[model samples]
Target: MIERPIGRDVVARQRFARLFSLGDRRAPLSWSPGLVLGPDDPELPVSVAPLRSTRSYDSIPATITICPRDNLCYPFDSEDKWVAQEGLVLPPSLVASDSGMFGSGLEAVPVSWNSLHHDDSLAVLDSEPSVIILIDAPQLAQRPGMLAEALLTVRTRFPSSLIWAPGISGPDNCALLTWMGVDLFDLARLRHASSLGVLLTGSGPRKVEETVNEDFGMEAQCTTWVQAISSTRAAIREGTLRELV
Candidate 1:
């Protein structure tokens, strides 16, 4: 097998959309892009938004970071309505609308295949997206080998595509994902854990003590956790994310 590239950073083009594949080999890929507002464009009234854990990721403004998910049809359907209402065009797709309807704004929805034998989505993404990120969810854990097979199948189908995975956090997890060539990841699970009173330190998870503090609530906790994730991203840029995790 050919070795995947390492220590590569992707630069997004002005009109490029970065796609992320979620779930197993049998599951289809789901992707979204990070949208940024142009300087000359009219700026909308900025909302002092509530926390994402409270208001949901879709309601939040497009920032330097992005978080996409696998089982997103449900959320996307509802979120797209707001997108239309807000008159915003998400990244990867050059669309402008008074209303945001998920999938409706895009020329096509991102799809996933069980393997190379079934990959029809690869062609569509290749025809577009300046860069594509492939992630191996299964490879992140030692619990299953089937995940690796599925990722391999996807890789074989899109060899020219730029992908990266496993993500930063765990040793075996990062190794497996990097080995498979997943370049980007969303760290929502860690945030979710923080919201649930779990603390992730250098040694891994430990429950937050009840006596830690009374003033910190869900939103505060999420903020704290997100800041840590931000630091992790910085580390990732420095090529030390895997080591920190």
Candidate 2:
């Protein structure tokens, strides 16, 4: 069973900046702190397990796992089995929501801001999940105003939960999302960029084919993103997160 040793902590709180902890004390996830490094687990823990019946191959769903020793995994739906096989799996506590239409028996409820009217959208927030995943985030990103409004509403209503936006992180938008109170980010974007032969730098993504080295790979791009996240987290801790945005 997944152990929730503590509820949540407002280690650092600001307009859009928040530093908090989740899961068991022994392996608590310190969000917005900085880089997270942990001993490798031959068997990776499963923090939040989406029911297998809910699995969909067409869309990649992100799963957030927190281990007893503080190892964190944000494996996509595709990687669930591989991740669980490598560690002591802790099944997440299920929370129900209207957004469950995306998938039933989810640890974190999905929220589709555009799918529902303002009132209907607000109703989904009533379930009060510790983590809310934004469904179809790429599409939501197109409607910045709506996305911002939905994020702000969640921040105001469910101040305790961490907001997770999958398939939406990159050098261009990671800082902004963090500043807006999103705590968990998946590496799908980075992986996608790498597949396209793009190198993600601090300034933005660059085509490797256009650059000197055609041999650049996803590992290097991931490292760059990790560094960027580390820097962003540091800025949050220092209370200068807004400056980075």
Summarize candidate 2's per-residue lDDT along 53-102 as a digit string, tens digits.
Answer: 12233434433343223333232112221111111111121222232333
**Model 1, C-alpha of 118: deviation from truth (Å):** 1.6
Model 2 Cα shift for residue 227 (angstroms): 0.8
In order, what lDDT does every prediction score?
A: 0.32, 0.51
Which consecutive 10 residues in model 1 have the weakest lDDT in total? 45-54
Q: What does each candidate score in C-alpha RMSD?
A: 15.2, 9.3
* Model 2 root mean square deviation, Cα atoms: 9.3
